[model samples]
Target: MSASNHKDTYQATGVFLVLMGILYLLDKWIGFSSHGLPWVMQKDTMLLYAAVIFLWFKSDKSVGIILAGIWLIQNIGLVIALLGQMSAYLLPLALLLVGVILYFISSR
Candidate 1:
């Protein structure tokens, strides 16, 4: 991508982060109930959103994949609880998937 394109991507990401921050602040200060809010609006979803944005807009995707993997690792307990004991296998499966994806991306 050209310099202008990178600049636009950065600007868009900055705007998105700013908007998320504003919403978070509003939720804290105004005591707005977040229960009815969409999953994307939740605080913990920011990293996932950022990862997706980076993967979509940037030429290099490893950072985005790493971020996404980190998010998944951090939320493993929750995932397991939701999916049951069999879900424990998902951790290794996810790691393998990430590794394969990274390998393919890096080989290109």
Candidate 2:
């Protein structure tokens, strides 16, 4: 397939993922039983969706990677807090790691 076609496919897949996540959240909002951890968080879920959308549109992946990294840290921090293992350093450390990953990905 052509490069354009390949990019289109990725964009389509990203849209699908975001739509699915939104639908799931809407269902939960209406008191549906998700019966488990959400596919995404009630808070900061937009980061993931926006990251996917941005990644599809931009040649540089850093924006998406950074957003996704922040999202992951938020969600995981919530879980860790619940377990009483959360730390003040987690956010900085996670952000640093994400920045490194973004630099490497963008450099390629």
Candidate 3:
């Protein structure tokens, strides 16, 4: 690839990795979550970041697939939490949209 293309790709991937790092830190540092919301040590969030790392080292398309899968599952739980009688539905809604947006960008 051209220098510019490589730089652009690196920039994108670097940003993604940084974001994942931030999430991991937040999950570790901030301990505030119930059962439904995506929190630290949770499977969905952990998987998302792990996929990010994997994709960064593996392939972009593969990362996209992993992100999409994680987001899909989170989005479903978010919907259920919001529409159903649940506690603190706001966080899930936010997390759901974030996951969807991230995977959307990754996938396409």
Candidate 4:
């Protein structure tokens, strides 16, 4: 792929990563969840952002592509988990919409 193509994909995935990341942080810090745990700061969840960074650093299609693949997979799982939750319908829908948009943009 051309440099521009890579940049576009990065831009899309980067946006997705940042938005969800902030959402997670806000939910935790603002006491949105009553479970005494921040959803975004979870150990495993942080790996997705780390992978996003790796995707930025990786120039090779193999490594970066693999990271992107994993990122998409993880995002799908996150969307599914969120859908299963008891939160208001709109929030989950918005999250799923973002996830779908991210995956669609990232995969291209």
Highest lDDT against the true fold, candidate: 1
Q: Tens-digit lDDT track for model 4 on 53-101?
A: 5566545445555665666566776656776764457566766987998
- lDDT (Cα, tens digit) per residue for candidate 1, span 8-68: 5786588668867887787777655545656545555887777777777666666677887
Better of 1 and 3 by lDDT: 1
Off by over 4 Å in 2: 1-41, 78-108
lDDT-based ranking, best first?
A: 1, 2, 4, 3
Q: What is the TM-score of each predicted model, taking all chains together?
A: 0.61, 0.39, 0.37, 0.32
- Model 2 per-residue lDDT tens digits across residues 6-42: 6865775677577867767677686344556454545
Clashing pairs in 4: none
Top TM-score model: 1
lDDT of each: 0.74, 0.68, 0.64, 0.65
Instruction: For model 2, name the residue pairs that clash.
Output: none
Q: At residue 3, give the lDDT of candidate 1.
A: 90
TM-score of 4: 0.32
For model 3, name the residue pairs that clash.
Answer: none
Candidate 4 lDDT (Cα, whole model)?
0.65
